[model samples]
Target: MSTKPQVSVAIQWATEADHPPFSELSNAQIRRWVRACFADSADITIRMVGETEGRQLNNDFRGKDYATNVLTFPMEMPSLGADSGLPTFMADIVLCTAVVDKEAKEQGKKPLDHFAHLVVHGCLHAQGYVHELESQASLMENKEIEILKRFRISNPYVLEGTK
Candidate 1:
């Protein structure tokens, strides 16, 4: 029996305005970006919500006033050895599409490419990647770049030239 971790993704979008290119981007595409940075057996939720819900979640959890592009809520639960031999749950990745679009334009990146970057970033956070320190930030950024490359997307930081 294979012991590879199962990758499961549940995606939700808010209304018509925040609709993502679900058909243009397949679950495999998003999953590949995530799996490249995380263990293959991870379970993730990628929710695309509007400003209101995004703002509420951000404020409630992070005490931020406005909606951010992506928010990660990790399960952080210990595992119970099961027949599947994989953790039952991982974390949730919430994305504000409106913010993503705006940031993409501001950062001068294609919407699809920016969306992929955020998905990769959010999934990494779900898998316990942090950017609180310079070292950690560098590591996370490197991982995001590697994953995005697999999808033919350029380095997000390079395009935005933040570094």
Candidate 2:
């Protein structure tokens, strides 16, 4: 039997974009990605925001002055809770629609595919996966490739003419 965790995803759209369909960003898809990366059940909230909010949050929290594609905020919870049987992992993933669109176009990637990759990347971050070091980055990227493959998406790190 699979030991994948149960996932509860909450989506918040703070932008007025009619491009990417809702079905592409459904809870089931997000849950599947989370389950693939994490062994513990997770409660994750994905917030889609505009450039302004994304920039502000990035600057305030990460000290970066630009609006990135996705920002992850993992919530650490105490392990002493004995009541609820819900997942212990929790996180808030912020996706900047404008940045995602722009990067997708620049990278010659489909918006849905880019979004899927970012969501999976952010979910991995929530599970304490980081790419600060070369070894860590390789491990994380391999995991991402494996997960995206299941969704029939190509490796996101591959550039045009390099494959």
Candidate 3:
């Protein structure tokens, strides 16, 4: 018998918006994404912020001036215990709600669906996935597609006008 790794997610809403309810960022939803792409048990915090803070974080960490939909900050820490076979993963995922809302509208996608994709994408990054190269991007994208499929979400890379 196999067991899934345990995931603890703490969601922080740093910005105010008349968007969906906070329940949308449920633990089950987050655990599903984390488990799909990672083998280790994790402690993750997801923060929803406005464009200003998001842009500042992006600028400081990634050197990008504009705010991105999501940013993953993986933590470097020691293991919990030696006897525990599972590794402990810790990360902070920041979501720019305004950017997510804007991008969803522009892309003709549901906000919930787009949010789910970004969450999954950010979790994968916490597990060391990257898209800095063409091959790496393809691999990461394929993993995202498979995980999103389980959530009944279509491939996010497929835009509205594209075949």
Candidate 4:
């Protein structure tokens, strides 16, 4: 009786930077995080990289000079042709391990918890969700909050230990 969207998730750890073999960043956990955000089936690849590579990608693609916590690149929409039940959604979500860890400490949040939020945030962007406007941002944040609750994670925008 599961209505979750089916996704083909591939995890890639392109940067070793001491990010080895952690249960929090396991494939199952990543898949669950993405599934929680998707309304339709998707083919997603999540990659973790060091700050250098992250900065390079950001500068090359987005014209930014700094590494970010998460970056999502949505691929071209494919045809849902006859006899093709495969998902048309395709995207690659990249997490900069150093940046994420740094942000987690700065924000007083657990690294894994922040990772979950970023994954969900990136997934939503891949699905065409945006926070460029106030209303849209509110809607997206609310969606993220609800999704996080399923994993017993608190509202990310709210300070921990306060309500």
Candidate 5:
């Protein structure tokens, strides 16, 4: 009677960095983090990339100029109706490992902990979560905190001085 959602995740590592080695960020670890966020069955691909690919994707799709920590590309609406019993949500979650490592160091957080946060964040985006508005951002941030708490992780939104 585990309450976890049925999420099928495919992990691809395209990064050449060694900050967080394969042993530190395994596919099972990624899948576990993403699965914790889903309330419905999902199909997700988690791709780890380097700065070049990350920057290119950000420029081409999001029109940004630098590599970001994570980008989620949710698939279009499925042709099959919701009643078809297929996966209800689908997306590709891209994580720039180098950026993630740097951010984690700057934030005074563990790399693996930060990785979990990004994976969960990206998965939520796949399920149509957004943080563009203050209200929406609050809700999304709270949800992330709640989910992360299940694994004994602290709130990512909290500033260093608060804790």
Candidate 6:
């Protein structure tokens, strides 16, 4: 029997460009990030889309005009009054494939590595990691570094200063 939590990953490409196996890697990355943060059970969804859809989502929800790397929509925590048998529903993470690939090339990083980092980032966001403040940003970055280290990836911050 499988012990992994039920996770739904949907890929939606608004453009004609074919991409890598993002869905499979995203699911594994999210599960790893979630396990690092929370011990309790979880259910989550991840979606990958093209620039047009990404821009639309960003404009509709975040009031941003351009497409972003990732966007996370977290679910409300279950209340005490709710059924105890219910599992934690974390959130949805929408990734922009165009943005991810472009940024990776510009940053001189492998596309797969960049995608893995962003997947971890989105998963962290679902687990309440935010960059609205310096402290939160530090916490999130540190966690990301730790998590990425296990996968043999270098620290993401090292590339930021040169770029």
lDDT of each: 0.80, 0.83, 0.83, 0.85, 0.86, 0.73
Residues 1-163 of candidate 4 have per-residue lDDT tens digits of 8676678899888745345323356778888998888777789999988888899999999999998889999998867672487775789999988888888888989888888899999998898889999999999999999999999887899877777
Residues 2-83, candidate 3: write the lDDT tens digits. Answer: 7777777787877463356334666567656666766667888888888889999999999999989999999986765846
- Please give each candidate's TM-score: 0.85, 0.87, 0.86, 0.89, 0.91, 0.78
Cα RMSD to the true fold for all candidates: 2.8, 2.4, 2.6, 2.3, 2.0, 4.1
User: Per-residue lDDT of 57-158 in model 1, one digit per residue for the tens?
Assistant: 999999998999999999976666566566555888888888888888888999889989999899888877899999999999999998888879998888
Score residue 141 of candidate 3 by CA lDDT.
97
**Candidate 3 residue-wise lDDT at 2:** 73
Error of model 6, residue 115, in angstroms: 0.7
TM-score of 5: 0.91
Please identify model 6 stretches exceeding 4 Å from their true place: 1-17, 20-38, 81-83, 160-163
Error of 6 at 65 (Å): 1.3
**Residue 150 accuracy (lDDT) in model 3:** 88
Candidate 5: where is the Cα deviation over 4 Å? 1-4, 15-18, 21-23
Candidate 5 local distance difference test against the native: 0.86
In model 6, pairs of residues that clash are none
Which stretches of model 1 miss by more than 4 angstroms?
1-4, 16-28, 81-89, 160-163
Cα lDDT of model 5 by residue, 6-123, tens digit: 7899988884644544356677877788888888889999998889999999999999999999999999866688578788899999999899888988998877888889998998
Candidate 6 lDDT tens digits, 1-163 = 7465544444444453246644345545555544554444556666777888889999999999999999999888766543575556567788888889898889878777787788778877876789999999999999889888888888887785574
Better of 1 and 5 by lDDT: 5
